[model samples]
Target chain A: MKTFGGPVLFLDRDDINTDEIIPARYLTEITKEDLKPYILEDLKLPGFDPKGETTKAARVIVTRANFGCGSSREHAPWVFEVNGITAVIAESFARIFRQNMFNCGMTAIELKKDVIDALFSYQDCPDTCITLDLVGQTLTVQGGGREESFAFEIAPFDKALVLAGGWVDYADKKY
Target chain B: MGKTTAEKIFASHLVDEPFPGAKVLRLDVVMCHEITTPIAIADLVARGKDRVFDPTKIKAVIDHVTPSKDSKTATQAKILRDWARRQGVRDFFDVGANGVCHALFPEKGFIRPGYTIIMGDSHTCTHGAFGAFAAGVGTTDLEVGILKGVCAFREPKTIRINLNGTLPRGVYAKDVILYVIGQLGVNGATDRVLEFRGPVVDAMSMESRMTLTNMAIEAGGTSGICMPDQVTVDYLWPFIKDQFASKEAAVAEFRSWWSDDDASYDKVYDFDLSELEPLVTFGYKPDQVKTVTEMAGTPVDQVYLGSCTNGRLEDLRVAASMLKGRTLAPTVRGILSPATPKVFQDALKEGLIDVFMEAGFCVTNPTCGACLGMSTGVLAEGEVCAATTNRNFQGRMGKGGMVHLLSPASSIAAAIEGKIADPRKYLPE
Candidate 1:
């Protein structure tokens, strides 16, 4: 699931809770695919229409601190996965949200505050390309004759699961 | 070596090296609710694994989205019910009989000291109040536990929060915990286990301890535990004594789970409970707490006093006492829900229900109710409320409905005044 480069959908808000990720009204649907279209609907974020050109074309979601801060609903990460968002880079994540991301086999990386701010600055330039290298523990932003790399870390178990295409695949092999 | 309460419980479940790191640990109880169980069952069925590893250890409760708000949620509840029956899971609780899973699990004697527990809801940390090492896992992990009888953990470090001194009047578990969360930011204790020790914890009642542990997850802690002592046994005895050979045996078993005196901790914090006042959270995050006195008279449209947190019998009693003979403001609407059916029955028997009803409070049957913003007393857009529930995030109470989390006493005060008011005036000095 490693993508070489993609457009970044910058959600620059801090403390983006699960309630905002996918509201409780949308949680009754058991399937991830059905729940994807409603992601961030509660927050009323700009340009969040799931079927719209921008949200569909954006492969990466960059945000500030405490992304997915409330509730343990896996639907928050499932929305990103089912909607074709492969990577989510934030300043930090709530533990359960990060765990949910790994469980769904999506890459959730945490960069420093400065690195996240740098990424958020590119929101105006939608054409900017950010490449995530899971194996190399680095995120590269390349565009307009500028390329910068930021290093990050993931727990050994999460790394293995994400590399193995999520928890189900890992369980299929390990269990 | 001295082990923290969490390390002690985790080691008890370890089949190999005792240190904290990635390893499969045995689980004594695995819990699920309507919102999370359907996905877990679907995943298991997709893998062609219909049988649960241990039917007896699994608990399925239909608490969230109960009363069939919509056909979709109703179908999900039906799926959980049918799956639990087919799997021979004996602990399933259908709508009327079930309350919040966090309360019902421990109330039904599923959680024991020194045990490792996992549930699909984040507030599963509430079970850690019994000195059990419990944490909330996502649906996938719950599925893994159902199939494997074990769940993986990365062995959490311990933070010892030493709360001492007797609490001031009108300041209780909710206030102390909210104050702690305020001091320690929302992510302060992320991935760490919190060991609540010191004199204040020992003096607190079982219900109060549960409130403390229940919100520990709000601070991002993996688990919050208190040492099992006489207070623990006394509270759990009535419900769990029959399971053991004798009362002495049950007490002895739980007593053995205490942490060593010299136990080394990764970090420690000291707090004097007397310094706390009634706390109310103003912003979206729980950590944005302020003293009730500071935010009193802040206007509100609704007041909710129920959830896994602060929804027990004691919590109702506190609210009832404050609301007795006093009617809510014409502008304010109050909704009260007990944490469990037993709590509702006890409140009814004690006439606490009359006290609330007489004051124009809408008392409902036990369910998660409006805590998750699913059903029963949903707030309209742009409405503000003072609530006793845990989280105050956007859309937590309803779409565009703002919630300020407070203790039960403060919640009643807010209702009576039609705004956030200091609850200390209602309590004895």
Candidate 2:
């Protein structure tokens, strides 16, 4: 099984769309690697900077509801994957975007609105970290000398895709 | 147990039940466009599995950035062109004949009731207007559909939205759907299909119904569907005539895809349209909707009247009617693009193109250009646009630009006034 644990970046907003995740202008590039520097370049969040230190150091994203709405481009998730941000924790996600994350061997974890609010409490904690344990189906967040663990669920097929290192490998075995 | 329309289609096309509520289904059509398909093709080629499951069932288009904006976009088109030719995909639409994929595909009669379609583009839900189950997917699912003709999904639950009462004059399908999205909020329909029903939808033309469904993604819906009826049969009659004895026969065949009367729904909403007014989006999110009166007089730098949502002949006619005998405000730049070659030709034949040009509008070929800010009509920093496209997300038309989503009639009014204005004031009294 696969798991992820790393530094976290928090964006407190809803309906963060695909265009904001990876702007439409750069979609012409042929490779996933070409999409790295432009991830979240168009996002207009108050304190977030695409080129800042917080972005480069973060390995996960915690945001509010409907984290990836609008266009169904997979480049949004590919950008996250390339930047080493393999997990996005949100109240909910746009359906296609959630699936694309799993297809890339990345995780999109959904917690309740209240749980998401609690997670935001650690946003200002510079040392905050998130550890996603797929084997135990749990998410643990620790920072500011406080820690909490929450149970999470992933569809069996999505878990299988992640364990198999994404859809390409899973399909290679099945087909 | 009664079944929703989506559930019925899923049951018929099911190849396997992966888990309790997840289904593996056989797809009827796999649509591809240059921007997203090139990566899938490259991956398949690298794996030595560059083969399409069924060439006849695939429809390819080079649309997003046609006439290649840059060397990179040119390379993207070449990959799709070579792959389609190698696979013998006859339905491919290249630059001269190409339009926006969502608009062009349906114009060619590629979609039908009960069919299941998948495309890498989010507006693939627009095809669901024909009572089909169509969803936008990602590269992995597109690759699987191309290679194996199969895709997996969680079995769908549906939300039935009943559009009741007659629409007041000057109100259009775009307004009604915007109202619905405003009420539901962006995430209200997440992971669910929206079945649009009742007399209002029944009265809408196929083109109008398509406009309603095309924005399904704006509300995070899997698809937005209307039960196939006589309007659908009449719209498709020319292409389907040889397959059926009569239009009624075709209609009868399609009626089987309708939801059962007792069908269970996750939720139901009844919207009264008698009080409806033209609507527009004021913020980056599509759900941030307000009445045209509430948004009037907001200065705009551009007015774009096209995209799959509002680039059809009906949209052009409505916009032309408003622009007749009126020129755009000197401060506003107006651009119009018909959705397909047919729409463009028909608009020309009907003098709609002349009306727009005479009104100081620049007409371009059918590309999904400015809708996604790829080439034509791109907005500069801090500029604002009144557009008839689906989404109004931040920087959708260009970096640091703001977009206001509205109907074609409203868009033309904004062009003439150089600000957001209600189209009803210009309507024939």
Candidate 3:
């Protein structure tokens, strides 16, 4: 299934490595099903199953700068995929992480300060309604039904890949 | 115009054949690790491609996930193993067979003179030890390399580094690179090619040359290349003896790309070799280097003395000599990974490994392990490590692990005292 739909996961942390999301030990397996278990086990987020598991319903994860900071391991997004994360929203990303995320059919968007805060507050307040209009470059948030909007920048190269349904779809056409 | 190996190859491969100033060119060798290879393969499979464009041109290794630490790493290795077997890749060294790809690729003859090599790994530039034009590429771009045999190419500007005097007693090649990174800030060599030339370079073993070129990536350069001379020929002769057949032919082929005596160079950088000391990087940045003497008393909990750079026999001997009859400090974790099977065997024969193990150096099978964060020797939280590997990006070895990059000499010195220190204290007078 194309995991465009999501229940956004608010993982509040600083500098989460890809290994934590998808333990590097899973990278040897040919099937994603084998890697689905043990997702984020190393990170102490024990409940998230990498091989199976609402983590599946959550296609979007928001995080802080230097997010995905570590080895050039692609297991990060593979775990995200096996766990059903189709998009990653962050304030910043390690270059390698961004590439892996895109390669694995996940959309990683970088939102500005206010937009990030809007998402955080929405998760924090619960009453705050937030929706990311990635195509329009605007993030709208409503608290007590009051709405606000902010624009986000997506690099042209990234936009081409993410918007095109990720690497498999892109390589089919480009390569 | 001054010519860098990258520029020369770019011109050779370019459709328009750009001279000095040109746009980014196609890449040659596309490097990939377990971390990025899965996706690249998925993309390839989704497209129904049976095999890589040319398996001979690709170089794959399992350095990133050595010792198959946990289930996750083992899984990564499984996929890598299957893929390499399926693809008939010309060079696919099992993790323990070689320590680091950057060092092993050249040692195994995967990197040849006058050829262009590309890797999915950022440190692909390390293969330039044999004077090959190499570069790092993204996974997607690497996929492109696999689909089509060649990568686009444009020449890079040239920077000539001339080492005029004999190296100081304790200063090794790692110190030379650290010194270069210090002089030229982190981004000093952006898009430029660095060419090392001097009697010192000509005198260096091929392994040492790999050390010089391996760290060129840290300087923000496109790639680094050494002009092949007799030393290069002698080192590679044994491996390609059957391929090249005649030593004379091999030497002739090597001499072809050397810059002409009046060869134009974009910039000429001079270094007085005798002045360099054993340099140790105190922080994540390769440029965050200071002399070993200057960093005395700065404690380190871990000391890693191997990588693509300085994991060769000579380096092992130098380190073993430092550890003979000396026990590593209780607090320090001293680790060594020989660059290749051949290097490891040489070290074993020379009794270097036994000395190291007896002195408490944690020796592991050859693989990129720990250096790039896919191994058993990861650093614990808030722990500071002195390593000889290239690239000290934040949390490189492990989460929240602080790495201070150092030459093998400094790494041994630090291991002995559990702090970054001068190798002279442990060196033979």
Index of the highest-lDDT prediction: 2
* Candidate closest to the true structure, highest TM-score: 2
lDDT of 3 at B410: 82
TM-scores for every predicted model: 0.96, 0.98, 0.75
Candidate 3, A17-92: lDDT as tens digits: 6556655444556566676775665564434443333454566676765566544455567667777667778877
- How displaced is residue B382 in candidate 3, in Å? 2.5
Specify the CAPRI tier of model 1: medium
What would the TM-score be for candidate 1 when compared with the true structure? 0.96
lDDT of 2 by residue, B1-429 (tens): 899899999999998775677688899999999998999999999999999989999999999998888899999999999999999999999989999998999999999999999999899999999999999999988988898888888877899999999999899999998999999999898989999999999999999999999988787899999999999999898899999999889888999999999999999999989999999999878889999999999999999989999999999999999899999999999999899999999999999999999999999999999999998999999999999999888889999899999999899889999999999989866
| lDDT by residue for model 1 (A96-162), tens | 8888888777778888998888876677775777887777878888656667888888777888777
Candidate 3, after superposition: displacement of residue A48 in Å?
23
Tens digits of per-residue lDDT, candidate 3, B56-95, equal: 7777887766767777677767777789899887577675
Model 1 steric clash pairs:
none
**Cα-based lDDT at residue B201, candidate 2:** 98
- In order, candidate lDDTs are 0.84, 0.92, 0.71
* Shift of residue B62 alpha carbon in model 2, Å: 0.7
- List where candidate 3 sits over 4 angstroms from the true fold: A1-175, B15-32, B95-98, B152-155, B242-248, B260-267
- Point out the higher-scoring one by DockQ: 2 or 3: 2
Tell me the tens digit of each residue's lDDT in model 1 across B108-176.
878778888888888888888889999888888888778877777778888989998999888889998
